[model samples]
Target: MIKHHPSETLLAQYCSAQLPASLSVAVSIHVDMCPVCQAKVAQLEAENAKEVFSESQLSSSTVKNSHDTEEVDFGTDLLNLITADPSIDEVYEVEPVTIQVNEHNYELPRALTRISHGRFTQVGKLARSRVAIDDGPLRSSLLHIGAGGEIPEHTHTGFEVTLLLDGEFSDEEGSYVPGDFIWQDGSHQHTPLTKNGCLCFTVVSSALHFNKGLSKLLNPIGNLIY
Candidate 1:
């Protein structure tokens, strides 16, 4: 039972391919695990397709009227070519891929299986593996929290998008399970903790601002470490 989800604006941007690669990947992973989002995305895609088709039809009608003897149906030709392929309806099997973190193995989403990732960097109870994606200022990574792990209270300098991949964690707001999408900005602050360990895919646009205790001192190097 996933409780959190990407906002409607984000979903629309995802369907239009308007999001940055890292954020897009986060939304995609959420959609993979959430049936509710899946249906919404499908509907958005259908609507986009219909709009494009309508424009194409209007263009084709104009072309036919311009050249009276020449009648060309671009949509039909394209559809025929696609349907002519013997493997068009065939489904291919995808090999399962998993990543190990904190001595625990968790399977990755299908969308992430092919993306390259760097070696894990460990810091206390947290481990991070950077996903190899170039999205300007956005950085994406897989973050793992060991059992009883507690992240210091912090706020984002820009924005943070987190998709829980496995296990469970709780913050000041509430508890989050696998497939939960958490979005945070400069206005939000919280300390996250996991009792039995958890794995998450995170995309951050900037460094975090640690708010309390000794962790606050790390602000100088937060951009480099986090």
Candidate 2:
């Protein structure tokens, strides 16, 4: 069987609708592939059935945009704060370096074109997307990680959610195959590269405040066009 995934608690929080859409989708894909993470998600969901959804689970507004970047360190505390039940003793999966081949293929999928094709006039090809919440800027994204693509290492201004519709990926978190979901608070940074080349689905909130200067090169033609 495939190895465990990046984090279990993070994924659990996402499925329970505790994390932001962006990060929630990421963690979700991870859990889909790793049974360990899935189990934790199930447990968390059951608990939430009795308990109210945690507000602290995903604090998107606190991420601090370019204007507030100074006030927020935007480092560490990347992951959201969560309370896991003691009964669920599963361990979080470690991030993976090389993604699994043949895990899935968004590269060849046409249905996904609907999402990938959408671009903002300035944003160009949207590498990220967000859920529309009141005018609060609480956003999320479905990243178009291309085959053999490598997403740069960036820290979160808020939370990040990723879902692997096709292909497999891994980072400091762990390996994620298709159907896998991952959740990350603020403290996550990893460069992901596909092995055999495949497409990946991801959702992220509080757009990653990229520390690296590759933004220009990363987007190039698609920059802000989306």
TM-score of each: 0.88, 0.44
**Candidate 2, residue 184: lDDT:** 62
- The candidate that wins on lDDT is 1
Report the number of the highest-TM-score candidate: 1
Model 2, span 1-226: residue lDDT tens: 4443556555556765776543544454555456777677778777875454344443332455477465432223433223234544665544433222233323422322223233212233224433233224444334554455676676665655555655566776667666554556567776666664434454434555444776535444432322
Model 1 lDDT vs. the true structure?
0.91
Name the 10 consecutive residues with the lowest summed lDDT in model 2.
Answer: 117-126
Model 2 steric clash total: 56
* lDDT of all predictions: 0.91, 0.49
TM for candidate 2 is 0.44
Candidate 2, residue 16: lDDT: 58
Give lDDT tens digits, candidate 1, residues 1-226: 9999999999999999999999999999999999999999999999988987886674665234355666556677556757889887977687889888867999999988889999999989999999999999899999999999989999999999989999999999999999999999999999999999999999999999999999989999988965
